[model samples]
Target chain A: MTATLDRPTAAATGSVVGAWRAVWLRVEGRWTWYRRHWTASLLASGLQPVLFLAAMGIGFGSQVRPGPLTDGVPYLAYVAPTILVSGLITVGVTEAGLPVLSGFKWKQDYWAVASSPVSSGQLFGAELVWIALRLTFGAAVYLVVAAVAGGWTSAGALLVPPIAILAGVACAAPVMAFAATTKGDGHVFAAVNRFVVMPMTLFAGTFFPVERLPLPVRPLAWISPLWHGNELVRGAALGGLRWWPALGHLAVLVALLVVGIALGRRAFQRRLVV
Target chain B: MRSDEAIISGTGLVKRFADFEAVRGIDFQVRRGEAFGFLGPNGAGKSSTMRMVSCMSPRSGGELRVLGMDPDRKGPAIRARIGVVPQQDNLDLELTVRQNLQVYGRYFGLTRKEVRAKAVELMEFARLTDRADHDVQPLSGGMKRRLTIARALVNDPEVLLLDEPTTGLDPQARHLLWEKLFQLKQRGVTLIITTHYMDEAEQLCDRLVVMDGGKIVAEGSPAELITRYATREVLELRFPPGDQHAAVDKVRDLAERVEVLPDRLLLYTEDGDAATTRAHDRGVRPISTLVRRSSLEDVFLRLTGRTLVD
Candidate 1:
């Protein structure tokens, strides 16, 4: 067909739309890569969650009593929702950060995509979508384990999927932005986990309320995704949503997801367009 | 893509890495169904030009059109319609040969059934039907390269781009790849290839541009280049390494042109037989003598003042 008219004129309009469609296909192909490797996913998603639920919820629940520590509720029930949110954070971090970087540089997965018709923005979107799917697997399995541990006091605990998804989006946003800007393996992510996630999981009312922390340190709970997800999950599970505060937490996570995806898109454009 | 009148055309194409000029300034055109080649050595900017043409890297400065679409703006459209065989085999090591084709076909937006059919056909074309389900990691370098070529063909591109298409392959592999490419040409597929081998240029390219240090030093058909820049035949002389310079000086005027190297002497002449007689009359007894028809290598050496291989 190039012999009749001109060739360059046709390509300009096509590359963008082509890039978008190509990315989705790449996501499908990458996901299909683990079909035969289901044994690993089986261990991580099915078995690991049950083990964690038993050890962290049942074993540790016995050590901490109700009322003074868990607002007079069963310790296992109180800790279960918090762990569900934290589990999302764990899976989201792995799927969004290290894997993203490895695909782009270390493993040269991005090179394979770039050489194709796919654009970088589209690939990044597909990457996020794939991560979201992986997060769902872990979150759903953990929610089932939470239910089996008798974590629910209200029927609304069935809304675990939405709550966990929101938690994942909220948690994945900053990590996505940070991943886009990452050049080499930086200690910044490691520090975020150690100084931020670890402390937040330990102190941000995962086991008890923020009021139990030092009077001045209670505000630290506002910045953690774990706190927001915890509030929503715990509020629904224990039949005690503050209404206004739950909406506020949900809004913060939405904003973070927007910012993260936007930043990631821009970074992909900047890095790949050259 | 445009009406496919001009598969590729460029005006004042320039590509540079920092201040280093990879392609200083070149203007060219490639019509559909034609086979074009860039014959140059390493550091000759052949790969750089190929990259720019493929729209993977931006041109430093130029007016370039591929399939009548601006490469800078419509990279995906151009790429979708083109098949690329890079110098190195960049096959997906994680997938099977059939899956590699299937996945690459999907990247071009082929439907599921379309890719499946394409995979089967490509595996047969590459003669890897038996290894279609095997992981690509264990495949030989030649098999991998064939699969890469097969993957490129999944999209059924109008124009194909190849860079050093058979650089490291054994003769059998190179012959098979060449046969496949020839078949594509017969089917009216436009091909743009870059290579440094004289024989490869002779066997494939209808027209070629010879480049050295980012600038095209000459441009012609394989035979035309030899006729223009080199004699019809060449006489080679190998002397003791230590006395090469003295031997070259002793027989400087015996041939039409004399190129003195550290270990050998190249005597360019219209009749290599006459040159041999002249050398013999001059009392020059070389360790060895080889007289053969001139080739692109001679033309390239004559224009660039250096050998093609290191």
Candidate 2:
């Protein structure tokens, strides 16, 4: 109080592009929080993916025969890229769940940000960006660990992290839209874990090829964004992806991400600005 | 062209929530570098109006302007030049005290270097330099409120909107906060505050509007409103709890007006001593009697026929 500074003229910065820059600024806020608590998130983004690789890929792979279903590759090599994508998806879903609820309802940090120069749409974009960054970090850690575990067969495996990030966004965007509309303490996140994410991770060709599943339930794997992501990452890592099929899987993930972002923007606007 | 002096102006502003109208078309203007206040009870739409001015809530109808820009279209632009301290402390509890200031500063497009320097200045200004690295969750309510005020100042805003700035604060904390606000006023920061405490309005507000039932019932400076709606002094007569009603009938004509409360009767008059002596001469035999100068509380009660706070 009674303090003075060289106050700059308050013309809105960047006019048109300022909104986008504000989105990054909001992401920067989350990054500050993440920098302090990244270790806490390590168990979810790092350890869990490595544990799954050890338990399902290496431990269980030792018993299974090298067969045509696994395309003559070792089980650890076959499942490594898929688990990377799965780990990102899990991180995406969890990030979009309670944290989104807290932003809207409990903590209301979204409202606080909206009170500033940032718009609700920009804030939503920033949240997705933060989630994407987390996915990228998780994917990087998983890729390094998997590479050391003899999971890499081709240089195309380097493309897995980006593909995993796309998969995470595809899963995160819609769940964030749903989370934006929630009012309770996020009990639905548990249901999303048990009924949606867990099943998708298990049945979407992470452990075995979807072709091995019963035909009736095979459509679920086809419909799951995780499966498309797994296909893209595995095809890239294993160097077996056909051109048209790969494009089709990429298109599906992109469509889901686009639609989810559209719906998410509307939900956030209603919750924050309205 | 709009007047540069009028930082905030609203005409026939209305706010409705489904079936209920929160603000029923009120008009007001706040000039540059002046402390303006909305004094109202809990349901009196002060917060609703504040939200609209802050550009966080869209108005249901009518025209509103902040810093000469329409809030409906220029929300982010208008919000960029102003700071808002909401009724509740929405400070980021997970972040350290300094981080809270740094993060909020970045939202205004301040660079990390600028924010860091400003955070240091603000921490010192709020007298929280010692708690700079500590998490915000452990700070006292006064510290949080002070930090919020400091955060609001990060943008060097042209106007600062504070809703119930010291509602839950203790007496000493409230005084400290008021001292800070008074300093802000001295520094030429336009302040818009909403509170039910008459003393807060009288102490901080250069001018204020008394609102009730979604409408402004009175508008003037504290002393002006007191003079217009209340007497210069008031005499309080307590004649046992149950006898207050009976006592009102005896001293009804002794003062300009008589108000009967549960445990006491208030006599509004220009001269409290004269009224009290006249009441005693009439054999009123009051259990206790006291005279006090009229306050904004008297003005509010006279305008709305109820206490400012329930």
Candidate 3:
């Protein structure tokens, strides 16, 4: 009976449409895994952000009277948008780092997919897309909860989720490029969390103005994508962002994202193709 | 694209890692519906060659074609037609058995509906319907291996590439896998397999190449290779371990060739019974004796001077 089975026919050619479909296929795989295991990551990506908002925006806001740094706004409102961007950045970086390494070294699921019709470039693009989707979901949840907590003082705050997603891709793409180069047991990912992500979250003007930082350390925020995202999110949410500076921040984030994607594509091809 | 043309053909195929050459200038052809094999020990370049053919690894230097298209320019196109089961089962431990098949099918551009149906059929083929919804981590080694094979078939590939298909499987599991593979062969699917097991090669391969030190040392049907490199039958004589050298001197001229192993001495000749009788006439009886037909193992040992599995 098995002898009557016909061989599966191959696709006619590697057309552009086929390539795009392959990319979405990888995205679907990631979505499948996310659906099954998302609860394990919910605390880190979802609950932790809300807890931070509660502790820092409400608890800490009550201690600080309205001031210049707060732009005469309540501390909860001033800190809400910044936390939204920072939280998405955290989720983005976390998703792109160790998981990317595990895809290559531990689980080797990347290799398994690469053996099929999917190209390395498509795999890299799908990873960034999945990270962006995750960041979008996490940021949207945080925005709704913050709004319920009275953190939304301006109608412009509605734009923060999309901006937060851009910040996430900007952060995640570069980390994924670096992650593709890692062949170890996640020591690099741990080091990145400790040395790069933690410091950036604390010092990227999330809670206050960057000018108050020590002069030498202040430039660090200038180069941080999170800081630019923070400024944009806060400006849009607070209704006082100057047009030129917001455009400048957007340009920097876009430039970083482009460079990150280019590097990541090349790195994935190098690691996966051989 | 002619039906009579080779499905995979390579000339001067080479793969170098850093300064080390894993596949040194080798050549071969695989036709449609033929079961071909690469038989070698670990690091003998079998996996490297398989990777190159699968289009997962670009050739360091070679003129290669799969399905009549250049791999360098048409890897995804070529890969879409071929299935690969890697040496290590990289099944997603977090996903259920069914999801693993579904996700892999999607990579080949199969739609959700198509993959769903294909996954169901594959679950039946792999005999994992009972464990279809279970996580892959807790499944036994045989189940995982079978699942990997079933997943590769999700696309119904015209060619299936299996790397050491049953290396770590138990005897029963190995037999089951071999049975499935034989079924695949009967369906006229071109199979490219790499295994260090001579029994597996003999059982499944229509033609095969023996590799050692990154080179193809011999290539033919298993029977042809055995006839060319080994005697028709082997006489195994076990003596005291320390006295094997002495026994070899007594029975040296009785067979066409002799191999001295740690625990036994093998006398290779056209007739094992004659060789054993000759050994007995020489008054060299010390331990157990047995006669068996020559197999691919003896051929491999003759060509490479080393065991396939070490």
**Tens-digit per-residue lDDT, A46-91, candidate 2:** 6778888889888998888878888899988889999888988998
How many pairs of residues collide in each model?
24, 0, 0
**Error in Å for residue B75 of model 3:** 0.4
lDDT digits (tens) for residues A105-160 of candidate 3:
88899999888888899999999998887777788788889999999998999988
How close to the true structure is residue B133 of candidate 2, measured as C-alpha lDDT? 98
TM-score between candidate 3 chain A and the true chain A: 0.94
Task: Assess the local accuracy of residue A148 in candidate 1 as a C-alpha lDDT between 0 and 100.
Answer: 77
Q: Which candidate has the top score in DockQ?
A: 3
Residue-by-residue lDDT tens digits, candidate 1, A1-274: 1221223222211123454566678777876676645676666434554566688789977787677567568888887777767766766765677667666556555666676688777887888777777767777777776777787666877765578677776677668767767898856678777887778878877767877788778788867777888888888877768879889988888888888888888887665554
Off by over 4 Å in 3: A1-17, B1-4
Q: What's the DockQ of model 2?
A: 0.46
CAPRI grade of model 2: acceptable
TM-score of model number 2 = 0.95
Q: Distance from true position, residue A244, model 1, in Å? A: 3.7
Model 2 misplacement above 4 A? A1-17, B1-4, B239-241, B285-287
Of the true interface contacts, each candidate retains a share of 0.25, 0.44, 0.49
